[model samples]
Target: MAGGNGLLEVRIAVPAKDASRIARLLVEERLAACAQVVPGMTSTFRWDGEVTTAEEQLILAKTHRSRFEEILDRVGEAHPYETPEIIAVPIVEASAAYAAWLVDEVAAGERP
Candidate 1:
């Protein structure tokens, strides 16, 4: 279900090898309500003077949209990439119960 303005979209990039570990850490730390690891992503980009291609894992994190920057910062701190990609996209739909849980988990650190 749509979570109004409080809904967040958080994305992080990690090395294929460290994707799983970072995903677990983010969930355990409550930085993200949930994280989905997408595998076999091929990224080609210009680095230095030559084009480079690498296999990467894309992590989609669910959280309050307002907290997008915070989530990005956390991911950056934990990420192994010299320049990690952290992006957020608004969530359009989700299960009500799951959405509620996501809010609750994120509010864990806030004053009630």
Candidate 2:
């Protein structure tokens, strides 16, 4: 999702054990300016035509919209699930200072 600020709030759900590693990877690689790993989340969903519930970790990542595809690719490589839950929503509005900081941090690690 794109917006005037060109910022996105990406959400990625992973196994609780892998939460911190994934968050660190994203932030270290600059795929995300910041990543917060929220643990103790219980997710219930359908998989393979059956209902299931599992403990999960939610990683909330803040990044520029342009870095979304890279984030997906990187997460896919690191994630254990066959189809990981990776989604993003546009950050339609943010404080100017925060927006600028986010953009700057992500941009600092831009690929050639």
Best by TM-score, which number? 2
Worst 10 residues of 1 by lDDT: 2-11
Q: Which TM-score value belongs to model 2?
A: 0.95
Error of 2 at 61 (Å): 0.2
Instruction: Give the per-residue lDDT digits (tens) of candidate 1, residues 3-105.
Output: 4647776777678998888888777877787889999898888878899898898988788865666667777788887788887777777788888898888
Off by over 4 Å in 2: 1-3
Model 1: residues with Cα > 4 Å off, grouped in runs = none
lDDT of 1 at 61: 79
Give the candidate number with the greatest lDDT.
Answer: 2
User: What C-alpha lDDT do the candidate models reach, one value each?
Assistant: 0.78, 0.94
TM-score of every candidate: 0.84, 0.95
For model 2, how does the per-residue alpha-carbon lDDT over 1-112 read when each residue is reduced to its tens digit?
2257789999999999999999999999999999999989999999999999999999999999899999999999999999999999999888888888999999998998
RMSD of each: 2.1, 2.0
